[model samples]
Target: MDTRNKKRLGAMLLTGIVSLSAIASGCGNNAADDANAGANEQPANAATENAVAGAGMKDGKYDPPITITYLRPWGPDVKFKDGENQDNNVHAKWASEKLGIELKNQWISPSTNNAFETKLRLSLATNEPMPDIISYRGDFNLVRELIDSGRFVDAGELFDKYASETWKKAMDEDPSVWYPYMQDGKRIGIPILDYAYNGDPVMWIREDWMKKLGLSAPKTLDDLEKVMDAFANQDPDGNGKKDTYGLAIGFKNWINTWMSDAGWIFGAFGTMSNQWNLSADGKLEYGSVTPGAKQALATLQDWMGKGYLPTEAGLYDETKAAEDFTAGKAGIVVGPHWMPAWPLEDVKKNNKDAQYKAYPVPSGPNGQAGRHGTSNANGVVLINKDMAHPEAFFTYQNYLFDQFANPPIGGEFEYGLAEGYDWVMVDGKPTTDAAHTGGFAPEKYTITFDGARIPGLNMATLAKLADGGEAATPFEKKLKLSTPQTMLDAAKIVLEQKDITMQQLFTGAPTATMQMNNDILAKMEKDTFSQIIYGKAPIDSFDAFVEKWKASGGDQITREVNEWYQSVSGGQ
Candidate 1:
């Protein structure tokens, strides 16, 4: 392989160079040495070799300055207190001073969802130059179309080549991360791995009412009934007046949808509402119209008749229902752990005597209490086909994962973005309760978007919800700020109830017909389920809905889902 060895055999073996190049393909060849011997070496990637030179890092803070063109689906009025520019925010600013990278807004507006898609498609259609990077986080239909356009590069190899160990570990934790971008043997974009259990709804109750009413914590459906009965009739507030309802459940799109869904009650009855799933026999089944749902509906109807459920529940969203519970007008509500930071916090502030606690969804018939939820599936960095610097993306991402995401020693995560921007030492302490003029925006991720102090929502906020502790940093200490007593209580219940958690992880892409007729099928399902719940139709009417659902493209959707599974699994 050396020049001297090659020269000894070269007079009649001029083809040796071709064989050596093939042998050196796996490991890197020394380009300089090869070029000195008249071997051709390309000069296009020379810029990538020097990409990290001007990047920022000093002590623990990212120094220097680097800018990125970022895009996300947000309208102009999408509120940011510390934001001055349409494109950049505190997060991007922190990335500049802390990570030495700045994010410039390439384009932003109300059209982020549809407008972004149209813009991207038109650019591709017109053969316009693409940006340095595109982080696609929109509808899957567009993602699938992007792959077909062949304008993006495969990110899988680059990830293996340059991704930091911390980021790699994150990817390794879930193989499902590769689902969206893979086509045959090619991968066009990096799958964004968001947090799990965004839909794990837990039960919250007023501990103050429990103590005042001589009531014990409910552990089963029967016990829950008794508790609800008490909340309906007994003046639990001890004012000798009946003013509260047993539960503040809402029926809006948000209530029955992912994350804030109240479908846990259906799980008790052996049904899962609003999910497309495959059962033990491998056939796709809709859980909403089954006999189990009938049982669940019966229980709900009885509660409604007993005045245990608020009449306004049919009209409330999680926010409004939470407002009712926090205002002491309802005894129970269901939500995720972050509830403590928002509506639940308002409840605690409204009444100092209002003590609340979280509990698992009560056990149902057959002694099972189940809930439906799943991890997030989007928001990763994607590469354009003509983008010159894949290494630059990896280098910047490596620092983010190593320095911000994964904490070793000398980690700045505990301090938030920086001491002066988002946090400050007031007489030598970090305080969110106090005010700092133009200091880092007091609001956490709920506030900023430009560069963002948050690495990702699922990574930062949701991770903290899981690792809440009495011993937290100025960063970690935020977990203890002003969460309502109810949300903290509900999280405890969720920890215990996690055993029955189920997610339809393999639901896959919507079928061609589903993509076209889902609106119709969804409306049918909603109308049928609503009628059954309201007694406008007998439980037997569910049979008609089932037959009609199958006829209306649901069957085709199931097969397409199966086909996608086989495709992604390589027909495993």
Candidate 2:
């Protein structure tokens, strides 16, 4: 409860105004310094050729050290040892000593609110010398601006020339990963990849509550309603008080969210809330304004009237609503596979007997189970065109992927980042005890590679172990030791449903009309949907919403989005 409050307060405070000039003053004369630094440095391309020819670039380390300057969005989550900082952490030291690369931070900005975005804008406005690499995690408009400025490299040719077979194979899993970063037939940036289906939502239920109520996992909408009814009405907590709810959800943003979401409910009806979809006639249409969505909203209104959903769900944020599940006041919550590590696990802390299981969200009357698909890549890693050694970035990145990301059974990072920082010997085995590390800082190790792992890489060993398979690798053994079986089960379910996952066809930055009227439309949509679900508005209000949506810039946004989709997908 306190943590959630603190985060909310922090968000409000962080978003409060800060002087741009004051922040930019900290980076005095960086442009001049970068110019001077480059004046004495060899042209990156010539240096690359000379090194390959003269010293013969090592499969292991460079003969001569190479330095790559980059900007970082630093947050408190990244803990540093007494002698370490962003540019000199264990990962940095490892890169300098073993990979023969020095990582110099051009600047480190806060990774909260819009601090990093503000700093980047200032840097661009002031003509700050671009670093060798720039990692921007927010605002694709900024990425577009960077590309338009022509300061960044077109990495398509460079990537083909330098990316390793392992790295290439990982990227090959999703050909569309490059679409958002492409401009004028050039790949202006390298996609920073995360796991596939990272945003696939699932039903997380308290298994003990189900057993107590003599219910099975829900297979259809009727079954789901019965379960929620049982959970809400029958006192599944066995506390002898009617203080519990069935499903946990937050609609502060929208009913659709990353966690504690109700989007899957609409998705079960063959359309997702707050998304654009292709109609049978091959035209883009807003899902929230559809008749099927009206059905979903009507169902939610029924649930609300029957006390199945939390009464204050419309007011709570995602994490605040998660408090109900964690506090054992709710039995069913829908979220992504990573729930076990968070709100679900916290339930066990609140109630020692709490037993939760992950299951596929029940299918709707349409006989389909659906969830939103996540983008294959988070953000892009852009490089300075002036930096002649773009291949050097690839060499260092590929090594990290090959060596640390997908290491052999008994490899260097089998335990953690450093001996004492991330792990310690516990009865002859490495363990991530909080006492040894003071606090966890996994984000620190990933400062390089733009805080992304090899695509589709996650808990392979643990998932296999959860299926009663042998741990074939050292990393797998460690994962099996640490991860709970519920998480593995959830991940397996997510993988099983990868085929059914859907993403927006348009992945570009917001369109011009969207920028101007998106907020107005979003507020209208949320208000109308919430009112409908809360029974404050008639179900027929959806038709009115569709008309208003089309009139108030949504139609233009759709046209622009379809244009973007056509441009990226070659009008397929």
Candidate 3:
């Protein structure tokens, strides 16, 4: 389960601002008398003055409790205990009792049907008082709008000052995480971190079919074609229907989408369609128009002509394409390491003999292999410029990263949040079964959504286990007990080929040209690619499409993207 958007905290609180003014009374006192009175009172007021000066923070707790306000999207997935709600939950109580900080929601809107975004835009247009914090995970254009509104503070300095060493090290693992939230050489939003390489593609092949057909694992493009031919032409299923296809892919929306991805095909030829890749000359280049894409398209056209793909592939989306493989109609599909836990598991229910195994993606003719890389950060946390206690947010987050993220042995959250909620005593041992624990997930009440995570920790733990290391740590033991051996092997393969993963280089907000013409250009690119694969157009049409793409604002878009990259990277 990605659960990226589901792990978010939403609420708001209003802070009271007090203004103090001194009133001068005409007592006809001379300057000398007034000076004497001040000198006499200085000694007496010293202790009170120091207390007032240190009110903001004292021993990691606010002296005068401060309230932090936020706005977030809510969904039915967010549940509450009998007496606890979003604003008065266990997390909120901990903040108040332990940290002397109050967590409050300015307002909340349903996450469904863009209600949150619509209401946020209305607030922006009406110039409403911005909350102290805003946690957003939706459209990038809206994030850009929030930044352009000039109501949020530059978080770079605050992050440097208040962020814990653990938090800083986790963020340093991927500096590009800040690119999307950056503007005018300053970080306007704090990135909400998630696990690394969670979505990187690995080929999953039907092991039963491969063994029955007497075929080996595909190591190269030529080897892959032979396997595809065997899967499509050879009666691997032995049903004598001649209905099975070689590969399962979805191209209706995006070739590089989450499930039934086709990006690895283009990646084998040295380009990824619908992404921005770093060119040899240190510029951002659109992948769809690159020369390698033409070769990839020709190959897909050949595959389609040989009935290696579903005939309705052009109409299937990511989920629909995955259904083809899960329904036992296709032999191989490409997806993340977690596929075994999901749609692939259904293959077993449908056919007891069905067995799938993950494999490394095959290399191209030149021995170069590539696939899409996942971003570690999912959303951004924006700080209000008018916020009084900015460091308080960091204090709250630092505790989560240090203690709760990868909990220490025998720590408060080692088993789960709230024993009776997410975990319960089953014969003197903790168990997370809902039947025993009452089906509660108290960690969801956290302000940062799913809580803090070190981006590289999860994969590193899995790799260690894959390498035959002992599960010594709490986190490692937990994973070893829960994760399947097949996923561990997949994680090892994914880490082994980490060098070949190509991340989209342009992570900033959409450029002016992109904002204006991106829809038309995206539709044109998808249509052209789909048509070429279906053999409705000649291979040479790709060349004409490239020329038209460059002429139709792509050239300007490329320039703007590179300029933004340079601004963020300082030209490296």
Write the residue-wise lDDT of candidate 3 on 1-572 in tens digits. Answer: 01112211110000000000000011111321332232222222222223333657666567788899998776556678899888988778878887678999999787678899999999999999999999877667788899999999999888877776667767887889999899889999999886677778789999999999899999998999999999899978899988898899987767876668888888898987788998888888998999889988999999999989999998998778989888889999998776776667888888998999999999888787888777778678999999987877887787677666666666677776567777788998877766786666666667666677667777766766666778765566666766778877787777778888888888887789987998889888989999999999999999999999999999999999999999998876
lDDT of candidate 2 over 380-469, digit per residue (tens): 788898895666787677665554554554556666656776678878877766676566454355544333354454523334455676
- Which digits, one per residue and each the tens of the lDDT, describe model 1 over residues 1-572? 21111221221121111111000000011211221121112221222224434344343333444455545455332445544555455555655564455566566545333787788777778977666577655456566776777777888877766665545555654566587677776656775543344336777788888988888989899998888889889887767788988988876652344323468788887667766454666554667656777677777767777898877766775556667888888888876654555456567776888877777788896898887654434344567766555555665555544444323233554445445655567788765442662433322221112211111222232233334534223323443453333444454445445568755545344668877877888788777766666667777777788788888887777677777777776644
Which 10-residue window of candidate 1 scores lowest in summed lDDT? 19-28
- Residue pairs in clash, model 2: none
Score candidate 3 by lDDT.
Answer: 0.76
Q: Could you arrange the candidates by lDDT from highest to lowest?
A: 3, 2, 1
lDDT over C-alpha atoms for residue 105 of model 1? 56
C-alpha lDDT of residue 285 in model 2:
70
Q: Candidate 2: list runs displaced more than 4 Å.
A: 1-56, 278-283, 425-428, 432-434, 437-452, 459-462
Best by TM-score: 3
lDDT of model number 1: 0.56
Per-candidate Cα RMSD to the true structure, in Å, reads 15.4, 9.6, 13.4
